[model samples]
Target: MKQRIVWILLGFMVFMSSVVMAAPAENAAPGSRIKDLLAEWRKGDVKPATGNRLPGKVGLVWQPRLDDATDMSEAERIDCINVVSPCWFRISSEDGTMSHAALSPDKDYVKKAQKKGYKVWALVSNSFDPDMTHRLLANPAGMKRAIDEIMQAVKKYDLDGINLDFENIEEEDRDALSGFISRLGTELHKENKTFSVDVTFPGGSPNWSLCYDRGAIAAAADYVMVMAYDEHPGGSKYAGSVASIGWVENGVQAMLREVPAEKLVLGMPLYSRIWKESDGVVEDVETLWMEDADRLVREKKLARVWDADAGQYYFEYQKNGQLCRVWQENARSIALKASLISKYDLAGAALWRRGFETADVWPVLAAELENSQR
Candidate 1:
């Protein structure tokens, strides 16, 4: 009888510990943290007001390839921010595990952006390594270690926030992913820092795209940025718009079911894809900046045709018997996307990468932002 009673006590203790572990952190306010942040921002506690900035929130993803000598200089990077006047800048300079990650923050760049009244957030990605992401998310200890390193980096760099961009994760890590975001959000909120996440548009393949628990992530994060591009990514056999209007609309509708429109930041593509097809078979794909797309259009003297279905300009030319097609993203398409922000009452739009856009698109973006505010 004594042994049986002791066994029962151990079982009860285990159950209690499990329950404790499963509960959210004491400081976590999943559903209301973003509301609080916005309220504080409105009170002018976060940063001083600026006239050139957009009324609605806008963000730019900055992914600097360190190995490229031809990459934009610090001056150019700052100019891009000044031109766009985005409220948030997410720098993609860190990747991998807590101990093995690579962090390369350009102090001067950070200072310049901050001086321009932009809040800088450092992005931490899994480097698209599925195995590494699985290892980090599947284990509780690993998650804590990663969060510690991320928080340390956030403090070390004096960053305003962190953007969790863990991609290519296994389907099994869905709950783990939400838990990680919850814990991170709690910690960041304690410091009064923003915590945003980048999730692929829903209704895709299971492990690669649908791994995200969008509703849970929306609750935990200050902003759930839908990476709404890559509708016809490089690996795709078919050639099409990088992000068509129909695709984006469907994605937004699906996400709205899971995330509040106010918490959703529709990600817009600043680039387009050029496809080379031979005999109705796609041979190669190359990503082009807005400027490059225009130059290609001029060089080929290709006649522009409006694709009403895609809601963008389309151009096609044949070179060496290979069909070359370009789905251009100019002021019109960008303006349409910006209008969607107002149409759906979204948080705003986020541009994928900073340098890919042209100057002509900025004014259109600003105008649409003004309209959205009105």
Candidate 2:
């Protein structure tokens, strides 16, 4: 998830039914053939997971910019982060066609990352549109086209796998969404590649929380990257840590009930929010990157104090009688969160984004996850 991909923009049903359809006779009528094929689609071709290539691995959610020279280079040199999931494909059409924006995904960057021993699991997103999602799911032809296109892209690019990052879905579509993931995971597994999904915290708004049938999704995909951030996102009643240690731990524990330890990856947020409050009323929430947070703290002359309970440095200052606050994510905070991977014996850790993290953060991740990653 990127800065633009706000965690606050909240967002599966579990319907398990099976049907049987007989194969069409040779030289059968065109209408009969179409009916038989549609029946087969409804029956579901759920395939077994191929298993994770790097179960205990470190991953980074990549937000591709014009120049990824720095990100690509760092990932190459850093041995800890074994997986690179680039934001690549998008569900662009109501008819389920993926949009190919000019150079949205830099193929050369993919090759470079792979050459350096990174397992490139290119990300496929829903663009956070629920109406479009409803139509895409309703149309069997559209759904088929989308899956075919995704599989084609993987084969064409020789990608190691896929990371499904669908957001802002309606609760009514839970079963439909589960079916989509099951089908996609099946196809991906047939190719002998990893399939994963990005999910929000368990108990939140209906758009983000209730829509995901976590247990069913886990049963389908090879891995599930639990986005443990956004505890206090923008437009919240109060300001708090983007990912407090306690809240993150709770989220991880909640996910573990549904997803297996080896099949779950903890997603860490690299950014924090700078909250401006007046008379205890929230005024504005500004998303802050690691370097930006450091600069703002110095410029505003805010005093930084350690919140042992939250396990993050808290900074607050009064400007013109307005209270400004930030729960800063630093190396210490990241180290504490990374420790959860080991504590819970989880699969590994994945940073929310690439460039948002300060250069110094990677070493902490490497150090903490060294034992966690087998």
Candidate 3:
């Protein structure tokens, strides 16, 4: 019971998780119940809301390799996906200059995705620098520069929208962050482009959780993607699931109190972590794709145990006399998370990044979001 309470208290998951449609209602016909949920969630959306362009199953592209040599692109699975948020832009330099290199080299990639009917939302981030974001938002010019660059990029690339992922912002700058979102959102709406912002669960670390004003954000942006993964991060002192189902559900419920279901996008994880521990103290952590996590299980022949409280499969192995454990994201776990989409009547879901999941996971997600209509 104490463990369950900690599960609910965890805030702001790290790394990235994907989100999308939820599972069919309990003991109900999937075909009918899904339609009912969709109808209810679509009651008041107007012309350019992200939900309008969704089956809302978004697969985030993380600097996918140009030639498809190493990174396996999820573009082929557009059958289950409708939009892609590429990690295309960021303000990483000390001076707050927006970098466009993330998409420059992948120009053709965006064109191809669009050609396949996928809405491409270029992701713009602050590189998670609390100090930098605080300083940048303090200067109106810096904020305008960032927003102007995003507008120029959308027009230049004919992209569908922008996914503003600003993290590590100071709690004092909460209103400033909301102001910036409102400003950018105004610009994007002028061009009829969808604008979405990424936020974490409420109440964990002050900067990550407290800095977000969910009510203001929901009013400014077309959608607010609640990142529901990283319940246990790489730097966490203890080892646990990247995102257990119970934790994610709690996060979504808490968010619904502030954000209307129609504008809330639950972000789920397509990856998992392998924790290397020495006597219960985490020493190192490795992030792996859902497929790689499966491969590691096969290679190590680790036993899979269902931790009912976690809603994930628990497995541990010894390597070089080191204790390694994982709480992997499999199809079943993802499907249960997906069920929350319908359960909550959210706008849609967005995955953290592409290429981190297995082929089997796509089918499950596609089925949950099968009724996704633009």
Error of 2 at 174 (Å): 0.6
Whose lDDT is greatest here?
2
Across 88-113, the per-residue lDDT of candidate 3 in tens digits comes to 78886534588854545266766877
TM-score against truth, every candidate: 0.78, 0.86, 0.81
Best prediction by TM-score? 2
1-374 per-residue lDDT for model 1 (tens digits): 99999999999999976665555443334335433432332221222111122345654555544334223323334322322212222212222245333435665656665776667766767677677767655444455666777787767767777777778878877776777777777778767777778899887887668788888787777788898899998999999999889989998999999999877888889899989999889999899999899998888777999999998999998888899898888889988877888888887777776668787776787776666666
Backbone clash count, each prediction separately = 0, 7, 14
lDDT sort, best first: 2, 3, 1
**Model 3 vs. true fold: TM:** 0.81
Better of 2 and 3 by lDDT: 2
Cα RMSD for candidates in order: 8.5, 12.3, 18.5
Choose 1 or 3, whichever is better by lDDT.
3
Residue pairs in steric clash, candidate 2? Answer: 11-207, 11-208, 12-174, 12-211, 12-212, 13-174, 13-175
